[model samples]
Target chain A: MAHEHDPPLDPVFKSSLRELKWIIVIWLVHFVWVLGYCSTYGYLTPETPLITVIGMPSWVFWGVFVPWIAATLVSSWFALTQIEDHALPDASPLPEKSEADEKGGADHE
Target chain B: MNEGSTAALLTFAGYTISVFALAILSNRVGKGKDFVGEYFLGSRSFGVWAFALTFAATNASGGSFTGFPALIYTHGWTLALWIAAYMVMPLVSMALIGKRMNQIARKTNALTIPEVLRARFESPAVGLVATSLLIFFMFFYLLAQFKAGGIILSTLFADEPLFQSAVSFVSQTTVNIPWVNQAEPDYLVCLIIFAAAVIIYVVYGGFRAVVWTDVMQGIVMFVGVILMLGMALWQVGGLDNATRKLEQMIPPEHGSAILSTGTVVATDQTFAKGTWLFDTGKVFRLGELAIIREGQSSTVPVKILKITTPFEVEGLNAKRISGQIPDPGLTVRVTDPKPYKYGAGQTGNYVRNPGPDSGNDVGFLAIGTAISFFIFWPFAATGQPSNMVRLLSFKDTRTLRYSIVTVAIYYSIIYFALIIIFCCARVLMPGMEIAPDQTMPAFAAQLTRDAGIPWLAGLLVAAPFAAVMSSVDSFLLVVSSAVVRDIYQQHVDRQAPEKMIKILSYSVTVIVGVLAVLCVLNPPQYLQDLIVFATGGLAACFLIPMVLSLYWPRMTANATIAAMLGGTGMHLGLTCWGYIADKEFRAYSFLGVNPFIWDLIGSLVIALIVIAVGPKPNRDLVLKFFHDTTSDGS
Candidate 1:
């Protein structure tokens, strides 16, 4: 439980905000990467030869398929390595086992 | 039932029974915990597997399985860009507020989003408003899920004699009922069965059951997609071959036509909807069954197809294709065959950026719409109350961290694999546009049969079925919580007895589930559209307010309420304007951007302005939410 006299902006809250900034940055980067590449090369002229990379069209391979793989890696790194884990505050204990609490099968299987 | 249908039905029945068993086990697990918290929040304890799968499964609803595949099959490769934003959905949706909100909920011991808000501000009004908005949006969401469930079942059992008899009985029984009679007989029969099964399991099992089944369903979805991908790739030869075929393929044209049986004395042959037709070496698909009874004509819709590519034609011809063949003595004519407005008689459109559209010239996913979807997927996910509830249940931050990465990888695989599998579906099963939403299941049966294991179709169809069930259970629980915890317990009787609360919870779940089914008896036309509307509405109502409440210590109750109302008003107002303009249930996009973007902007601006003008939050509230109050003795 936080107190009135304690200083504002605890370590947990500050770290959360910092993590939020990084997450937003990641979102923006991927958004631009996918949109820019896809929109630029997705529309093609009939005379232009259809380019294939691996199995997918060059634009789709680079724009969506590849970025999707990269995103998984980047997100994994961020979640596992960058973000900090803090203990959550425990829930306030229930009233010392009222008669209703003592009799528990009301919510049946 | 045919051998294939029997196998599929048995597999589906086994899956459903497994789900019920999990529900029973979950109920047993709830024996000793606090009744309200255990049933509603799973005692706020979820490990990585449970948390990750539930979050992913709930988010990947019936739309992901049915609507997404349909779009890919209809529009071609552009859906890749349309849904590309999913790459960052995990980090953005989970990392943004998962930690902060979880911490807040723990401190307050809040079991619901509305409860969290009410406790944060000490305002009953806030809780009431939140509850009202949640139930409103989620009710519509539940309706869409029910409809999806019915549709999947109907498609699975279309060839079953027992199922056909049940449909006939249902149709005859409800023929006089105004709304019920309007629904398709198969859909109506399946809807009742789906509704009964879901309501019983969810009401009995509670949140833990929902989570347990979600884990199983999630795995089913993943395995189903991987298998389908393997079969599709194998059947289509390889990815390179499929893409090459797509490049040469031309988009089909849809139009209305009148089919006439000649005046000759010949028996009338019937052409079923979704069956292939041959006319002048060009292939066509019947949009509706044309039964020419005794020298009469039937006006029906048809899709004109041009499959000149010898490679695809060979595959089609190898199947010993079955379609109606008119007698040589009978004269037949098709009138008013409309050509595609865009990309008519053109090749290579399927592999291009915007892809091809039957109606729109700029393509199915224009630049503006593409950008809108890029923003829509991740951020919209963040604002969902169902996702928020899952975030609150993790055992610890480590679980959260691991779950985020798991979901990111999970979505990347499922989405990318689906796009590949369905794109290959175009080559294997051409002319699915007659019933596009059935593409996933229909293609699954076809692929499995081709692989000489028709029984596997059951497991594949269960993927979409599981998706619908997972979503339905979560939404059902959410609505029940809102009613029982937020409304009845908090406002009606804060000290309601445990037995009463339990009974009320069960009753509410059943009632809400039944109401949603009844509402969907005459189902909506587009599943994806309804999902978009409900999700967008909820995000609009809760996202900004909840985010500000968690981060800004000075955020006032007045501002939170204002932001919620303003966002809801903006979203609905724009949707209404869209309906009037287009005469359809779609949102009006200003400047080509979706209504969600504008609604979110308006919501943020409103919240900030209100926070600036309104008085600060109560000092005690700030200390409770923000400061380290453990050090300062109250």
Candidate 2:
């Protein structure tokens, strides 16, 4: 538990935040690709020949299913290989941040 | 009783019996565990398989099996895209918080979401506010689950011998009182039975019992849903045929079914006596035609009696399909009905059919709505109090990894499989104009009957029933814990004895269950809508505060309070406004976003801004949540 006054932030904790940023970025890009490219909504009207991939709609095959399969794989990778299982090192005092850094409070920076 | 009803009733009974046995078994096995911890959090002792299955079952409600499929049935191929967001739901929900949640939970011994928030911020009011909001929305969710159970039971046995005999017994034995008939709403009997079964097992077993039951039900639902999916494909020959069958291009008259009985039982869509039913290959649902009288306008209110049946029709590639329900059944009952046709196509270019929410012609609105929905529902699953309860009980980080894989695989199969099943259903059972929520049971019935194994239908019916029960039991526990652990024990009586706490926990669970059942007694038709709003409401309320509290160390108690109460009030206030102002508020979007998106966006923005500019929190509060140690480093 944190006391009234604590030591400087741990480097491991800061890196985890950095890792969180990268993960969110990767997933957000994937989300856009699935929605904008895979799904043919608003572009293909009802009159268009329903293109099929592996006997399913092209949008569903390429968009929803393919993208999700990738997502699941990536999620597994993150959970297994990427994330640090051990808790961050105890909050021992470290080199002090500059005045500007302290005011900014963006520790992950 | 007939074979179908008997099979259904027996399957349901078997499921209930298993639940009771599991509850008893868990209670017996829990000798060494602390009562409060064991009853509420399963002593924080769940393995990978247990964690994965319980998490999945708790999250996937009856809505997934029933209401979701109906949307697929109503909308054509586009429904798949509408739900594509789910592919990332498990990942987003578990990954960001997976490690932190498990570590911090053990560190603080927080039993509930409210407890976690309270300890993290060192503010009792945060706990109170969060608990109040969870209880408020979760009650509606619980009510929807109970009502969904009732609907599934009633619909599955509506024409079955067992249901008929039970109704007959009641109607014959009881006197007919004015206004309140003994056998009216016929769904009430099924509702009561379902409620009692759920309450008994949930109260008896507690968290361990719930998780154990979830594992069984999850497996049953997984296999049962897959079976229905396979049967649906087989009924339509293959996925290629299923898609082409729905893709057949026909004239506007093709939209209306050409009913041909000896006499036209329904006049709305019936054409001549000899020609084929409109020669339209595109059929999405079963058609219901009102039998009109002389000088009676189609617009005026009148009695509507339905007679629908699915029969073979030749479509593209000269294929025979049975899903086009063409002929009306009650021609003999109508008075002098003649073959007639009117009100052909409403949309001339409705070619590749769109799902209910997704429009055929993708536009800005469609893309925006899709984006909003993708974010909304997935966040709901991740941020739900019910799901959080399971996450808190996980034994270790390895369990989290296993849960992620399981959840991803599980949702991928179930969501995609449902789309296939209902799409095939469109080919095999179109013109079914019942309540949209009946899509699961209706499709399950056709899929099983077509497979020549009526018994499988019994188990398939149990799948959705299990789906609802899993969600209900979990939510019930969360609400009860919020009251007993977060509010009563924390605030009202901090010195409460352990014995008293155990009793209170059990009692609170019972009281909440009974109240939810009472809410379902006079069930409304739009319970699905209520469930959606409740889910969205939960996401709006908790997603912002919970995430920020963990990640943003600067988030003060004031910000947490603002986010919880303000977010909830914004959603509830807007929803009530929509209900009062426009009856069909779901159809209207705020600015360009759906109500859920708008609510979530508003709450999240407020939380972010407030944390950036709000009052500085106590040093201990931030240190406790963010730091691992203090000056006395040992």
Off by over 4 Å in 1: A1-8, A93-109, B176-178, B264-269, B297-334, B524-528, B632-634
DockQ of 2: 0.18
Where is model 2 more than 4 Å wrong at Cα? A1-19, A39-42, A87-109, B159-162, B169-185, B249-365, B585-588, B630-634
lDDT of each: 0.84, 0.68
Give the TM-score of chain A, superposed on the true chain A, for all candidates in the order listed: 0.75, 0.62
Q: Give the best candidate by lDDT.
A: 1
Poorest 10 consecutive residues by lDDT, candidate 2 chain B: B339-348
TM-score of each: 0.94, 0.83
- lDDT by residue (tens digit), candidate 2, B1-634: 5676678878888888999999999888776767777888888888888889998898888888887777776666667777878887887777666566655566667788987777666666777788888898888888988888888888777767767778677556544643234335556667777888877877777899999999998998899889888788877899988777666512121123322234422334332222122224422222343333333322222222122212322332133245333433322222222211221222212123233222233321266767776776567776788887787788766777778888889988888888888878777764443355677777777677767777777899889989988988898888899899888876687767778988898788888888877667665667767777788888888887887877777777778888877777778777777777677433236676777766766787777777677667666555555665543541
Interface RMSD of 1: 8.1
Pairs with backbone N, CA or C atoms under 3 Å apart (clashes), candidate 1: A2-B628, A2-B629, A3-B628, A3-B629, A42-B353
Most accurate candidate by TM-score: 1
CAPRI-wise, candidate 1 is acceptable
